[model samples]
Every structure is written in structure tokens, then in C-alpha cells.
Target: MSFTRCSLFSRQSSSDHSPSLLFTGLRWTFGAIALSLGAIAAVNTIITARTPPMGPRLNGLFGRYPARYGDLAYAIGGEGPPIVLVHSLDPGQSSASWRAVFDLLADDFTVYAFDWQGYGLSDPNPEGLNAREFGAQLRDFIRDIVGTKATVIAHGSAAPLVLEAAESGQINGLILVCPDGSAPDEPRQTERAEFLAQKEISDRLLEFPIIGTAVLNWWRSKPNLEREAHEFALWDKSQVENEARLWHVAAHQKGAQRAQKALLKGRFAAPWRELWKNSSTPALLVWGRHARGFESASEWGALRPDASLQVVENALLMPQLDAPQEFAGFVSEWVKKHTE
Candidate 1:
């Protein structure tokens, strides 16, 4: 009886201790995870602080104007009818998107290209910027700098901003390449939060601070950029090796995450369908046949009977980079037709 009692007491003691041990283990596990994240953030912050800027510069920086919101940087050269090129908005996109078309159009028309606020050469916007702010910047550029009617060309998500800014007679001609119509056309409201939860994990990570900057740097790393350029936007990724290198430089600029955070937060995209449909400005719409997530040219074309649509066979999202000569030709011919 004494031996059995001793054995039962021992069993009860171990059972009592097991819960405490498990609770201790859980605390240690959570503590380790928190420590690891903090260490990673600290390392990344140091690396970011030490890293110097990089570039394959856009050649000419026409000016930097202090606007009401963020500062501006634009390049201008060649002389004729004014033409403005607005680069697509991606996490790290800059005016580098226009290297080919900018030079080509410069020969026949005075060409302008700008780094959007929070991107290359332009002042970074740390408070975060949205399309409404971007539209204001573009409008001021047209009203103050261009100082006259001009033809505006925009790529991808930059279209809505341009479309909204091209107030009656401010832009006589508009050319949009692969403009995003994926957002709902039901309401014209921008700055919507409807798309926030739908973003990918990588994009959502861009909203955080040190960790976000680290994630943006990783995304902008040369190899990942090459893969993104290869698989989605560019038809000839090998040809844009220099552009990819330049883009890597632009993407790593300090405070680049501000606009990117806005981009991922659904601030840069909205339903441009009705806005696009309502525009009276003479327009040319182009799409790459291989583009992954956009509607067919025919679908977008149905909205505007007066507009011309072309689906280029050997291009993807960025025909400007892929087929510069051909894209410039399209613009040149179309503008001439409108001018004549």
C-alpha cells in the first residue's frame, strides 16, 4: 500500500509539472520569433543606411520645381510640338520606361519625361502619395511648364492620372498603353480601399517600414527584376538589360517605399473605365497582345468608337521598351493625322 501510494504521488506530480513546462516552451518559441524579426529589421536598417545610390541617368534633368505637395524632376530636349511621356507606375518604375520612345519622339517633337513624386531624382514623399496628388502634379506641369496644349502619352496605371488631368483643351491628344481598366468602372472615385486586402503578400509587406524597405530592395534586386520584366511586362527582356540595371538604381533610392506603399494600398489605381469612356480628347490606345491581366483591345475599344486601338503581336505590357521604333511610329503617324 505504501509503495502504490508513492507511485501515484509521483505520477500526479509529473502531470502537474507538464502544463507549466509546455507553457514555458510556448513563451520561449514566441520570444525567439520576436527576437529574430527584430534582429532582421536592425540589420536591414543598417544596410539601407550604408548603401550608396546607383544610376544609369536619364541624361538631362530639365528642372526640379517645388510643388505644393512633393517636388518634381523632368527632362526636356529636342524641339517641336510638345509631347509628354508619363511612365507606368509600378513599385520601382521611373521615367526609364521611356528611354527609347523619349529619344525617338524628341526628333520630331519636343519631348518631356518625368520621374513621378517618390521616384528617381524627384523628391521622395515620405507621408505617402496617391493618384489624386499625382493628378494635381501632372495638371500643374501642363498648366505651368508645358504652358500650352500638348500630346500626352501614359503607360499602364499612369493613364488614369493623365486622363483626369487632361482638362478640356489642356491635352489635345492622348495615347495610352495598357492602361488599367481592371478596377471597377461602376464609380469614378479614386483613393478607394476596396483593393487593399486583395494585394499579394509581397506588396502588402511594402507598407511596413524597415522591413518594407528591405522587401522593396529584394524585389528590385537585379535578378528578380529581370524575372518580372521577362515574365510579365517586356516582350524582349534581354534587350532591356541596361534599362533593368538603371531601374535597379532608381528603385533603391531612399524613401521609395512611400509611393510604393500607396501603390500597394490601392491609391494609384481606380476604375478609369467611365473616365476613359467620357474623354473627348482625341486618343490612341495600344495594347500588347501577350499582356497577362488586361482586357482585349476590342473590349476597351468598344467604349470609344472614335478612338483607334491597335494590338501589337510581338509585345507585352511595355511595347514602348520592347518595340520603341514601332511605338514611336504609331505616335508620330497618329499625331500627324490629328495635326493635319
Candidate 2:
């Protein structure tokens, strides 16, 4: 589907500028940004098509879901309270995001997790999908598909959206895995700046139509994609196979890009604060010992009334992948105690 090119969305300016002039200027800027993104998309597609596929297994998992805006392709399995898992920024994090938890909880709660807009089998958002918007979409999907009052389990940047949904009082419980929005206790000056830079790039790219498309397309390549996966899994650069998995997600799903842009721009911050302040849902926050969000969870939980924090003994960003059995058992027990 072709989308109209436009500049990054602009909040109304308080300037005394005339409406017509403002509108006209904004339109031109938007158009230029859109064209740029489109050109990038074309180039990315060309490069991706030339690259090899990850063979049959990866292709099979690349699927779609028919939602109001469009179809969202995701991975679904297991059965009980509906548990939707939202993955983090790491590539190849689709079904893999829920692997540890799914195996453990499938028998008890009906598990339903999907790659947000662009990561898994979900389609790309040519029109741009914001984090705040995705949160609303996810809430609606949970109410409509999984039924309201179900549990939400999310990780990384997706935690903000889930938090928003829970704050709406619709979610029964929440499980956050290495959530990203909290203010860390020991901030790294260089690392924080690097994250800021990447986010800026993601935000700028989203506005440029061709560039957005190209990035997604290149993202779908085996080598390029694998690199993403390795980074997400926090592995060494030599993990070619892992990187491919990450790329496969970008190639087939569009939501990932939209979600990425939203997170980068601090879109989820408001909702995150709202949920933490107002909600009564039982929350279990799990973080890796070495994860960026680890300290944030501990400090945040200490101040909250109904929240619990768990720091894995020795792990990275993905505790489930690093310590599956233990992670699964912890989650299962927590869910049982809270739900019952």
C-alpha cells in the first residue's frame, strides 16, 4: 500500500504566524521528508531482494493479523488468562521473545504475543505508528482479541504501551521484563548519549518516506538482520545466525519501525508515569543483572505501593533467554499468587 509522504508530525506552533503560511510550510516539509523516506525504502528493497533467505523455518513464522488499520502478522500458541508479550528492540526477538515464558506458562494461561508493528510477522507502518498510538491499539486488541481484564507481559520499549493500557484500568495484571522507560540509578554518560543519538536517527528516518522504507528493507536482510539480533540478544558480532533472525523480523513486520520511532522520541514516558502513579494492578518487574533498566526497576519498585522487582543473578537484557527455567517458574508463581 502506498502512503502519502509527509514531514515528521508537527505539534501546533505558538508563533504568531498566519495559519495558511504555517500550513503551507508544514506541507512542504512533510512532503520532502516523505519523499526522502520513500527513496530510502526503494534502495533498501533492492538490496534486500538480492540477499538470501534464512531458508524455510524463518519464512514460516513470518505471518499477518487483520486489524482495523491492516493485518498484523504475529506468532500465537499455548493456552488460560490471555498473556500478550511485547518484545524489545533487539532484532530476531519475535517468538523468541516469549520462548522461555511460553514453554512455562502455556499450560496455565493462554499466551498471545506478537511482534509489534514492524518486528515479527506484523506489517510495516508506511503511515507511521507512534508508541502512544500503538499502546491504544494494543489495548483495543487485548479487549477485542484476548478479551478485556487479561494480563499483559512486555519487555524493553513496549513496556510503556503496556503500562498505559494497565493504567486505563482495563488490564488485570502486568509483568515487565527489563522495561526501558524508567530513570536509571547509575546513568552512563556515554551510553545514554549513544542511545539518544540512535533514537534521533530513528525519529528522523521515520519522517523521510523512502529512508524509512529502505531501512526496513535492509533490516530484513540476513547479515544485516542477524547483526540486529545479536545486538538485541547482547551477543558478540560474530553470531551470524542470530543476526539473521533479527532481520527476518524487520523484513516481514512494519510495526517494529513505528514502535522504534515512538520509543526514541520519549513518547511512552507520559503513559509510563500515569500507570505507575495511578494503577492498582499487581506488577512484577524482572530485569537482567547487567541490563540497562535493571537499577531503574529496583528504585522505581521501592517507591511504588503494589510492585515487585526481581533482578536476575547474572544475565543480560533478556533474562528469559538467559535463565529460562528460573524465569518461567518465577513468572508462573507470581501469576498464580496474584490471579488467585
Give the TM-scores of the predictions, in the order they appear.
Answer: 0.83, 0.68
Clashing pairs in 1: none
Candidate 1 residue lDDT tens string, 201-246: 6565665665776666676677887777778888886766765666
For all candidates, what are the clash counts?
0, 41
lDDT of each: 0.76, 0.63
Q: Per-residue lDDT of 1-340 in model 2, one digit per residue for the tens?
A: 9875433224435464457666988899999988876776667666546544332122113345666666555555566766777776544455555655675777677777665654555655444455556677677777667665777788876776777666566777788888876532333886887877876777786666565555545544566655544555443334447546544644444345565544444554544665666667888888877765566775568557578877786576777767778887888788888863
Whole-model lDDT, candidate 2? 0.63
335: Cα error in model 1, Å: 1.4
lDDT of 1: 0.76
* Model 2 / residue 210 / CA error / Å: 5.5
In candidate 2, what residue range of length 10 has the lowest lDDT sum?
53-62
Best by TM-score: 1
